[model samples]
Target: MIPTPEIRHVNVTRYITPLREGGSLPAVADADDGFKYVVKFKGAGHGVKMLIAELIGCEIGRVLGFKVPEVVFAHLDEAFGRTEADEEIQDLLKGSQGLNIGLHFLSGAINFDPVVTTIDAQLASEIVWFDAFMTNIDRTFRNTNMLMWHRELWLIDHGASLYFHHSFTNWEKGAQTPFALVKDHVLLPQASELDTANQKLKSLLTPQVLQDIVNLIPQEWLEWEGYEQTTEEIRAIYFQFLTARLAQAEVFTKTAQDARKALI
Candidate 1:
């Protein structure tokens, strides 16, 4: 089993500016650690569920040897919002005056464009496999949430993944669900070795790895209404869902292969 990552906890010292590109309105904030982070507020429209998805998706990507930014738990003080001029931003700070998610900001990074940058076949195939396993629908060609920094590609903004947690009433429906949208993936055409990638990466995500990744999510984030399960119980549900998906990885792997074939 891979070592459990120690998630850093920091306090937000100052709110630098709002990143208005995303619908949730994430902001760049100066943390006490003397680093800048793109903070995802819990009060955002998507709520804490998005934060949970971001954390889980990031951890999974990291375990698969993908380039993902470091994530931290940032404590937002209520007084920090009083100085903000924008009412919307101030409200966001006020509501998220506690534990929020922060992603280490990559300075001087440019948005990845397939036209300008070429991804290697192996890396591309692994990334496509990972996204297919996670049921991530956000990595489409139009809004490729990828960045090129220092001539290397980095994954970012995984709030749209693990979408099954949004509604737990019929959560079982998500298990083993075929990801038909893999065809729209930005890297599908470049993913030439899906079979090899799947074989190699599948072993990395053992049950212990899945449990460890799910355990990284804050308990409060899982305390949604309409769920009868306790926080730990809810976490187990996520493990079960992922384990089921992993067991059926071949189904999604074939889907991605077919998509790549069509693109070629």
Candidate 2:
């Protein structure tokens, strides 16, 4: 069994430059731990849901044996970004004063290029299964959201995952539905072991594993701008959603398998 890892909290020591590659305007910041982290602010356009998704998605990937960056609860004080010259950045920091999400910076990591690096069948199948299980719509060939560090592929930008939470309604249907976008998954063509990945992964995402990931979401994230539910209520919804989804794992597995066969 893969042990559930602890998510640490850190204080932002300094705000570095913005990583403009992503739409959310994540930044490179120094933490009190003396390490650099790519921090995602709660003030971004997508709101707290993005941060919640980031925490849960990355945790799931980590538990599934993927090489994911360490996720942290980055505390941003009211005066954190006041020294920044950019007005836009100042506003972003002001709105994100409490807790945000950050991933340890993988320095010198280059974007994964399909032409230059090859992923084996097992890994590809697992990745496809993971994204599909979570309904992640971002990992397409147009923008793989994967990186190569020290010759090993690492996942990033998982804030687009757990898309069902964006609506937070009809979760039963959401859980029951198969992911139609598997056809566009960047790894689908190479995911020949979908059945194998399915059997192993289903057994790994036990009830305990799902609850641990849901528990990582900060209460502040649950208290977004215009929501009317207690944090515990929101948390319960997420856990149920995941539990229902996992019970129907084969629904998505078959979809991904068919998509791969069509590609071939």
Candidate 3:
């Protein structure tokens, strides 16, 4: 079994500023650990599910040897919101006066522009396969949520992946559903070694590794209504969905390959 990642907890020292690029209004905050973090609030319009996705997606990326920013659990006190003058910001902080998600701020990181930067075909294929396996739909040409730091690509803003959890009514059936949209992936044309990537990466995501990743999610974040199962049971459901997807990895791999071929 892979070593479980140690998720450090830090207190919000100060609210630096709001990142306005996205609708959720994530912020750059100074934490007690003397580090700046891009904090994703629990009270955002997207709710806690996004936080769950961010944790799981980033963890999965890390396991696959992708450059993902360090994710930590940030603790916010109600007092932190009292100093914010903006009503919206204050409300968000007040509501998120508990555990939240934070990505370690990478200074001097530039947004990855595909037009300006050329990516290695092997790495591109691995990323494509990874995104396809996760059923991530956010990595498109228009808004690639990636950064280039020290000339290496770093993935960010994975709150939109793992969308199956949003509607768990038929999650089992949905697990095996084809990711037909992989054709739209921005990196599809550059993914020239998907079969090799699939063979190498798929072996790393054993059932134990997936379970270890799911276990990292805080219990409070797992609570959801409209599901008959308890919180732990719901967690188990996630494990099942991921394993089931792994079993059908070839289907998604083929979908991506076919999509890439069509684009040629």
Candidate 4:
């Protein structure tokens, strides 16, 4: 289990708003540390799955040496003195208090846009490869979840990934392509350079490390359709795919490096 972080409380006002495309209520809370943070309510059933996935993903990303937001599980209470709007939304946010999740908000973060500074091809390619291994279909250009903060790319909003686990277990339907998500979704600018990205990914996808990481996720989270056996089988499938992909990544990485050396 990942160590939980300590949450602090302050007597300050918060502004709450509904996100355009997501299911959670996002609120901006003032911190004594003088920074405003974003906290999403975990009361809704839809938000619950997202909260769990984000927590696990952030930790894994950190282990993989990626820059992720400082996150903590928190509780918003009536004692903190909230706004009338917040109170109105409290019903929607009910049961989230004392167990809400907060992200130390990035003050000036911007969403990724291809028209903006281009993400490095090799780096982007690796991200796509990682998504494929995890079967994530939500990071498309139509709803790109990458955030540009301090000139680095940060991933966010993974509520839509691992969606196959939600449906009934009919192997034929499950194995079908177009897996309830568009396969040819727009790629990140660097995604086309898979040969280079695959190389890097191969080096990173060690079997032991991948197994350790996946095992860390709560068994409850892995279980699909409320069945533990199904969840275990699904995890095994991903593990096999990831292992093979890692080997491929190593080959690609070597080829790319050799090509680069030759050019130099």
Candidate 5:
């Protein structure tokens, strides 16, 4: 297996502000490492599973050369947010008093506007293929989950991807399943190079790489009360699911192409 990737770990020193735009209420805060990060608290919204999806999906995108923000583990202690006035925020902080996922905050980033931004055919196609591979359904125009910093596109908020894990029953079926919602993908109209991207990108996701990505999931996340399976089983399932998905890249890629065809 390829060596597991290393993500920076930092202690959250301050809760600067809550980003109300997201349902989970991730916050922008300063870490002990002298960097500001948008920390996704484990106690809010989708809980630990969302953090898992965010971690795994972001790493996969980064490996595929997407300009994703640097993800790190932001540690929150019991005393960190005690002084917050808002009841909801305080409750969220109390519940999330442990390990959480954080993305490096791009200081002056703006939202990506499909009508205004210029994207090439290859890049769009690659992004489509990537989303389809991950079974992501949140890249629609309504909420791009993307940002532009210094004229470069950066992907963010992948917590909505890999939705099958929410139930995780019959997960074997999920790996082979085609992503139909890709039709609503914001970049579908411009994704003319899907087939080419399929060929190039599939070769890069070796089994070792897949394992390394899956291995990045925190042990505590898997130990949640919601799951009936053992931690190892859960981890193996993620690895196997991704491996099967990569093996069936043609299935999902073709589905994306068909979706694109319907668009144009």
Candidate 6:
């Protein structure tokens, strides 16, 4: 069994206010290092679900070779006075007080927009495709959890995905399970532009890289009591996803290459 990360105590001198707020996970603050990390509390409430979802989503993003913020789960040791349900959440908060949860901080360095481009359409298409393959449903126009840095698109906030697993009783991983999203998603911004981008991804998302990405996730994170089963299940699903995606990649590559030639 892998050991859990050593929980640490932190002194957040100044609580940098959020640029925006709402949703289960609130945007916390950008630290002195210039990286803006979102601080979210874990308790016997809705935020619990969000925290779990985000951890899973980021792991998936890492596998697909996207720039996800370095996520470290930690506890908020500081006091913010009191809120409405303060007493009820206190124990869980105290238990979590130096213990980790999901992402610890957000780097304010990078920012991105799905509707806009300083980022190439091909790269954007891959980001969308990656999200689709991972079953991420949060990157829509209303709440695109992505960032733009150095004119590059950085993907984030995947805590809203794999809902089928969350509500497994209501949803089945049927034949439609695999490519269902691919057909409907269509790699936003059109396939015509993304044709060339796929080629770049072929090299970037090699099998070794995929394995390494999965390895980056601490084993303890997957071992969380209730989530372990789903973690293994998702791992298997992703294995199949990667194999199928890559098996057809050669053909897809050829198609893209041909499409690129036609455009010229």
lDDT of 5 by residue, 36-138 (tens): 9999999998898899989989999988889999999989998978899999999999999889999999999999999999789999999999999998889
lDDT by residue (129-220, candidate 6, tens digit) is: 55544566666556667776555556767666655545444233421244333333323534445545555555655565555444443344
Candidate 1 lDDT at 62 equals 94
Which residue runs does candidate 6 get wrong by more than 4 Å?
1-15, 18-20, 29-36, 44-49, 59-63, 77-98, 101-118, 168-187, 190-264
Cα-based lDDT for every prediction: 0.91, 0.90, 0.90, 0.56, 0.91, 0.50
Pull out the clashing pairs in model 2. none
Encode model 1's per-residue lDDT on 153-233: one tens digit a residue. 999999998788877766677867779899999999999999999999999999888888888888888887776889888
List RMSD in Å for every model shown: 1.1, 1.1, 1.1, 7.0, 1.3, 6.8
TM-scores for every candidate against the unseen true structure? 0.97, 0.97, 0.97, 0.65, 0.97, 0.58
lDDT minimum window of 10 residues, candidate 1? 168-177
In candidate 1, residue 228 scores what lDDT? 81
Worst 10 residues of 2 by lDDT: 220-229
Q: Which portions of model 5 miss their true places by more than 4 Å?
A: 1-4
CA error at residue 110 for candidate 5, angstroms: 0.7
Q: Could you give candidate 2's per-residue lDDT for residues 10-110 as a string of tens digits?
A: 99999989998888889999999999999999999888989988888899998889999999999998888888889998899999998999999999999
